[model samples]
Target: MTVSDEDLAIVAEQLGRAPRGVRAVAARCPSGHPAVVRTSPRLEDGTPFPTLYYLTCSRLNSYVSRLEGAGLMKEMTDRLATDEQLAERYRFAHESYLAERDAIEPLGTTVTAGGMPDRVKCLHVHVAHSLAAGPGVNPFGDEALEQLAQWWPSGECASKVKN
Candidate 1:
């Protein structure tokens, strides 16, 4: 889980700013550019950062932001109100996320990011979680991935990230 200088540069380019508390590239695009990043449980400045996995790809971020703008989060949250199995799974996902983050560095807080175990707030966080941890771990993340189209091909960054 080492983050190379080139990886940081590529991620910074993808994010359009310097990323904070980023530990490594947790998930890469098909073109091998960073899609999601694993961040420190706490930032260098001593801020408690609960978001473990962060989506970095500009294209994916834009798509997920569009999903948020389209009210998909409200619909998903509505389902959580009526779906028992899904709610249980989401709760488990939240627990797993918290446990993983705690393993890295115990923050002593139960609050995980992305509104897990209750409501869907950020599709980008969920999707980044899904990509970092893999499928079946995060139900909301999985659902968001299912809805997003294959986006890597449209914005290949091999040239920009050439070593």
Candidate 2:
């Protein structure tokens, strides 16, 4: 589904409140639709640090292609300040892009033009707890991890796809 500019703007605005310093960029697709490039900063106490971000351009390849065609990717790339987490996420995205490119056409499989896998989109979660429950507290909390475990399905994506 195509996201509208208003929706993207709302999403980006909401991202400003993320607990771990997350942010997003609202960009226009070639079809004049909207998408977001979300970034999460890895920081302790507001110092500049590593970060991770995902480009949610599910149908915006034409726009991205045009940007690339105009040689803007290089300029944009130069302007970005990267760190370990950002680099890691970029590596993951690049690998995924290459894999999707190689698997397309010959495999007769369908994927979004913007490179996101069809299985999942728009994942966000938050967790909060008090560091001191009382004078004497159990720092290692319970139940939270179990709850998270219950939330996700267990298994490899390949196995699920094969099934």
Candidate 3:
């Protein structure tokens, strides 16, 4: 997986900073812009960066932020305690995430992103995972994405950033 210079530039603008350890554009929006990126397990400086799939689109980030602001994290966390099937699926997602990251470079830690299996720490992470890994992978992320409106209809959020 290789990220083109154009994609990298767009992502940098989306993040408002230069992207580090971006291995590939894992997912793209409807308008063909980068939405999620697959990053290296460690930084170039050897720092452990466990976030494998990072969400870069500002519009998607805003939608996830809105969900976070609405206390969706707490609600999902609470549901995990009672929903055995959902919990099991989330645990699988966590394990898969760890495996993918370790395949790149072992971080020597079991801490997967988005507080998987036990909690819903960040909707952004979950949404990123869902977008990268696909549906039925991260239950919360799939649900949250389903709940949010189609954001790309307005315009490409990162279009002007590149121009």
Candidate 4:
């Protein structure tokens, strides 16, 4: 779970800057590179950071952006409104995210990233949470991950990056 120097290098390459409040490697790509990072609820400077799971792989980020641009968020939002079971599950995901973040340090905000419970604002956050928490935690996130193509053609993203 620890974020190693190699992981940091790859994350830096992914974000194009040094990441802050990164506590652990949340999830890895199929190629075994750091894909999602778990960040602290509060930053070093005492700023509240609600995003607990951060997506760090650029390729995956691009793919998720493409999905977002294609109106996937609207489609998911519509489904969430009509599908009671799906909505319930998504609510649980939001609660789980809040619980985890509160455990780290309470942000005192009900807003979980990616617009959980009511809408789908960002596929990137949902996918990161799904990848980090594993399947069945976030239905929308699980769907996003299912739709994503294998981004790491060159194997581990850390090894592929030039630091």
List the RMSD of every prediction in angstroms. 1.7, 20.7, 1.5, 1.9
lDDT of 4 at 69: 98
User: Candidate 2: minimum summed lDDT over ten consecutive residues — where?
Assistant: 124-133
Candidate achieving the largest TM-score = 3
lDDT of 2 by residue, 17-86 (tens): 3233334342332333223332333344654322233333332223333444655434434423444444
lDDT of 3 at 123: 93
lDDT of 4 by residue, 21-73 (tens): 99999998767778999999989999999999999887788888999999999
Error of 2 at 81 (Å): 6.0
Taking the tens digit of each residue's C-alpha lDDT, what string does model 1 give over 26-143? 9987777888999999999999999999998887888889889999999999999999999999999999999999999999999999988799988899999999999999998888
Work out the TM-score per prediction.
0.93, 0.21, 0.94, 0.92
Q: Cα lDDT of all candidates, in order?
A: 0.88, 0.30, 0.89, 0.88
**Decoy 4 TM-score against native:** 0.92
lDDT of 2 at 95: 45
Q: Considering TM-score, which of the candidate structures 3 and 4 is the better prediction for this target?
A: 3
Model 2 Cα RMSD, 1 decimal:
20.7
Candidate with more favorable, higher lDDT: 1 or 3 = 3
Question: What pairs collide in candidate 1?
Answer: none
